[model samples]
Target: MKVTLRTDVLTNNNKAADFNRELFESTKTLVVNIMSSPGAGKTTLLEETVRALAKKYRIAVIEGDLATERDADRIRAMGARAVQINTHGGCHLDARMIAATLGELDLDEIDLLFIENVGNLVCPSGYDLGQHHKVAVLSVPEGNDKIPKYPQMFMRTELVLLNKIDLLPYLDFSVEEARKDLSEINPESTLFPLSARTQEGLHEWFSWIEGAYVRCVRQ
Candidate 1:
């Protein structure tokens, strides 16, 4: 059965949008939606990012998974505010789901908001969650061929992170090929190649986030 939301619920989507926008504006938080396929190192990257910037900035995370508070717990263990959104059987997190969680967080105390969308290459790109930026994470093990197969996701990202570069030597992935493919799909998106585990090339990623936060604050 193809389940569908009611007309009233669809109509109320704007309310969610408005609420999210207002929350962001009032808090001046730089909300970043970090998206990618499962096992692409979204959580690992976020953990590294938080560790790198926590002393300099206040960070909060909203973790989305089909089921399990695991990701949220991980973030909380790091001393950051985190909330988990279990989608049950849903593949993605919509604006309304995000809007409903605003009350649970003290956004004013947060400088950055990282929403780790459910691990999927598709579906998540279709909706906007009132975020300032969308970062797409692609690991070397996933192959450089993903850009062509998932053009929509690539096209929508503001930044493309080529993660797990430390494994590049062990894998057959080509950095040049990945860059070329991404350029063909989205010539303007900024690309950062790094390994979240060993923290190689992480300085660039952290710098980008800091720059973005400054820009957001200035605006």
Candidate 2:
């Protein structure tokens, strides 16, 4: 019964995702779905990404959280259009939720649309938000065990932004071990160790976005 119910839910979600993908393609908007645990620097990283690329590309974000609109406000402060989706205790943002927000933002004026999923490891990974790319944010303070522990999130994502490398000296996290573990779990996935606060190793992430945007628009 559980399996049947789950399958039915995903079927509906996928249909909604297809609708969103079609709209995104039509408007030439590069949509990325970002997932991470709470305090994993998802918002801060987005703020920096916006600060660096907003002038070159028109960026917009859909902030998801259980209760507050804080993340959306921060992204808006960076001079980008942002919409907040308060899940009200939901663990993840689904394709249907994303589809509902589409009308709130005029996709024609947007170059990039980033959907920041609710801050949870398990639930967020299972749902498809109809994005061109699904990226995961893992912080140094969260420790090395996270990559292997949360295999679903890492395996489904094409890129992993290993944030908080600036704290390498203060913490006991191992970058090489994370690389090894991720390679074992998802060999094709790319891992970038960056600190959103210090702006270290962020250029690679931004470049990835730039490349993806070009590819998306040219398609």
Candidate 3:
């Protein structure tokens, strides 16, 4: 079924933008929306990233899942303020959902806010949650063809994380192919290939994120 986005939805989305701008202006937090397919290591990356940067920067996470507090619990365990938004069968998180959760977070103490969107490629790409950047993750096991198949997801993302590179030797995936495809769709996006599980190639990821955080805070 084709879903036609109505004008009201667009208007509401604009309101969401305004809310996000106001919240960021008041709190001075850089919001990042992490998006990807299920089991693409969104939460795992968040855990690693939080562990690396939390001491230097105040970071919080709002995890969106279909129906569980599991991801949120994991984030909270790392000593960061975490909130879960259960979509209740919805494939994506809308702006109002995020707006509702704003009061629950202590924005004053946060320098970065990472919203892990529901595990889907299509729906989440269409919604604007007032984020400063959209970081998209593509696991190696998911194959190199995913870039062309889901061009919108890649095209809109500011950073593309080619995760699960540790499995490349076992799979038929080609890093070059993935890079080529991504270049075709989004030539300017910074791509990071790493393993969230083994921590391989994580330093570059950490550096990129830290640099981005510093830049955002400075602005």
Two-way lDDT contest, 1 vs 2, winner: 2
Model 2 off-target regions past 4 Å? 1-8
Tell me the number of clashing residue pairs for each predicted model: 0, 0, 0
State every prediction's TM-score relative to the real structure. 0.93, 0.96, 0.94
Q: Give per-residue CA lDDT, model 1, range 103-178, as digits (tens).
A: 8889999999999999999999877888889999999999878989999999999799999999988999998988
- Pick the TM-score winner: 2
TM-score of 1: 0.93
Model 1 vs truth, CA RMSD: 3.7
Q: lDDT, candidate 3, residue 135? A: 89
Which whole-number lDDT from 0 to 100 does residue 213 have in model 3?
71
Best to worst by lDDT, what's the order? 2, 1, 3
RMSD of each: 3.7, 2.3, 3.5
What is residue 126's positional error in candidate 2, in angstroms? 1.2
Q: Could you give me the TM-score of model 3 versus the true structure?
A: 0.94
Q: Candidates ranked by TM-score, best first?
A: 2, 3, 1
lDDT of 2 at 100: 93
